[model samples]
Target: MAEIKTLAATVRSGTGKGAARSVRREGNIPGVIYGGGEAPTPITLNYREINKLIYAGHFLTTIFELDIDGKKERAIPRDYQLDVVRDTPMHVDFLRLKAGSRIKVAVPVHFLNQDVAPGIKRGGTVNIVLHAVDMLVPADNIPEAITIDLSTLDFNDTVHIKSIELAPNCTPVDKSNFTIVTIAPPPGGAAEAKRAPGKLCSAQAAESRHMLSS
Candidate 1:
């Protein structure tokens, strides 16, 4: 479990886009908190503190204790809008959480033991199909990341969402069976050539030949 440091925020009395822009000009990020049957509260947080949390790479799942106007509240990041050109955060949305409440959030997936995997040793490439997955978990026990063991994977072997071992009280929102990661022969190699008919040296080469013939 990864714990996120808390930040103190001040309630914003002003509203509208103009006010938000003014807050940004002062190096503060404008945010709103909703859910749990409470009225949305407009607030402003330190941009530096928010950036630090984003750099930690588990912003969504990491539990945050937001000190809003001196009142401590637990919340989770719901959405954040970023500037397209500068790639900086422009606006943020947070969801208020209650103890024992279940919330759905996307958690990052990490691959472990890749170097020791049998497939990689055999010159196979590991293809990741999903980087994150939505899961419904308790507010307090939300896992920062879901790790999958690649130690036992072999060539042509795949690990699916259903195969992952999830943390307690966490359940995948994706009910359909789906592959998360798979080990396959490298794109251009003897193994791939043997697998495909006509003995093409590589996928790109095969595509080029087809294009020329057509």
Candidate 2:
């Protein structure tokens, strides 16, 4: 479930480029809240407050309780603009979330038990195809991340999306099964890159030829 973080914003009295600039000069990020059966609201938040959340990561997926003049609304960050030069947040757009609403979000995938994987202990490489999966999750039950177990995976074993276990009311948006991760054999596995009969480097190849000649 997504943690609801509380934030404060104030309704903007004026609207325009100059007004927005004034808001920023006052150390606040200008923004709006639309959707969820209500009229759009133009607002502003403290720069320090928004910057803290923006840099902490996962701001988009997490739900927020926006308090505007004592009225609280459930919201999710829909979009944001950043300063081209300073990389600071310039503006924001939040979408109101309603009860039982299913929202599509990209959830990060976490692989577990790499040390226990039989293939990994043998020097096999764990390749991740999809680091995150897009899914439709009940807004109230947004998961922090989806976990995949690799404890039993062996060399050359593939992980498909369909094999993954999802939380209740959460399902992948991708209709077809797709590759997520794989445990592959190490490079140059039991085979010579240049020669078929023996695995040899250039110097070793020369040594073999000299031995045959001798």
Candidate 3:
């Protein structure tokens, strides 16, 4: 399950570009909370604190509890904008989530047991086509990351969406068949190496037969 985090924020009564700039000038980030059938609320959070979360990664899918004016709201960072020059957060949008609410989120993929994989042992490369997959998950059951075991992978093998182990309650957003990872043979050609001994033996037997016939 995805871990929940608490963020400190305050109510921002003012709105518009000028108001947002003013908030930023004061070392805070301007943002809004929408959805959950409640009127959208404008708010602000400490620039330094929110910056840490943004830089830490997975801000979009990570569940968060916004403590606004002493009132707590369960939400997630739906969208955010950054200052290209400074690479700092400019604006953010929060989406409220309730218990049992299902949302589509991209979960990170982590491969395991690579050392024992036949493809890796044979000097092949594991090409990861999808680093993340969008999954429909319950609000309280969001996964922090998805796992894929590569021990069964062989040379030229491909792992598709059907092979992934997902929760019974979770469903993938992608309807089409997609590849998660694939194994490619080495530059010298491992397949050729495997057939070299057989080919040589067959050729030697053929040469001996010709010699005897002659």
Candidate 4:
């Protein structure tokens, strides 16, 4: 397990949109830490420090040791506000965590052995129905990502949640039978060939019209 540590911040008094905008102009991100039976603590974090962590995709489940004015705290990212136009972070919300408590988080899923899957060799396409899964895990035992092996999957086969083997202390939130990935014939391979160029077949035409109607 890799431990991520970040410098703590001391917050001065500020309020409203104007103060937040000014903080951003100075290369700082306005944020707050809340949860765990304590009042929300307003704080500000360095923009550069946060950008690096966000860029590495480490905010989802990783714990950070935040050292604020010689005081230490543990936290996990809860929510983030973004500047939609510039695609930059505007603010962040961190939830203080306590040991032995289960936290709900979304964990990234990595597909392995895709190039060697039997379905891919047979002209099938892999469709990822779910890129990540919601799991309830102990805060200290969160996994970086869940890896799924697709080496033996055949066409029309699916990998479901129940089939996944999770690491210790990690449990998926969804029902056991949830489908995650499926191998299917490439779209419009044979169907497209059957339809006349500029005209759709009865089934295809009806489906298209229905889609437009909806």
After superposition, candidate 2 runs with Cα above 4 Å error: 190-214
Off by over 4 Å in 3: 192-214
Rank the candidate models, highest lDDT first. 3, 2, 1, 4
lDDT of 4 at 203: 88
Candidate 1's residue-wise lDDT over 118-140, tens digit each?
A: 77877788999999998898887
**lDDT (CA) for every model shown?**
0.85, 0.88, 0.89, 0.81
Model 3 TM-score relative to the real fold:
0.88
Question: Candidate 3 residues 1-214, lDDT tens each?
Answer: 8889999899998999999999999999999999888999999999998899999999998898999999999998889999999999999999899887898889898999988998888788889999999989898788888899999888889988887778768888987788999888888787654554445566788998999999
Give one digit per residue, the lDDT tens place, for model 2 in 13-126: 888799999999997999999988899999999899999999999998889999998999989898899999999999999989888888889999999999989888777889
lDDT of 1: 0.85
Q: Could you give candidate 4's per-residue lDDT for residues 1-214 as a string of tens digits?
A: 4255675776636867888888899999988888888888778789988877787775767788777667688888888887889778899888887888888989888999989987787678889999889998887677888889999997778998878888788888876688989988667563443445698668888999999999
- Superposition error at 107 for model 3 (Å): 1.2
Q: Pick the candidate with the highest TM-score.
A: 3
| Per-prediction tally of clashes | 0, 0, 0, 1
Comparing candidate 2 with candidate 3, which one achieves the higher lDDT? Answer: 3
User: Mind sharing the TM-score for model 1?
Assistant: 0.84
Go through the candidates in order and give the C-alpha RMSD of each one to the true structure. 7.3, 4.0, 4.3, 9.0
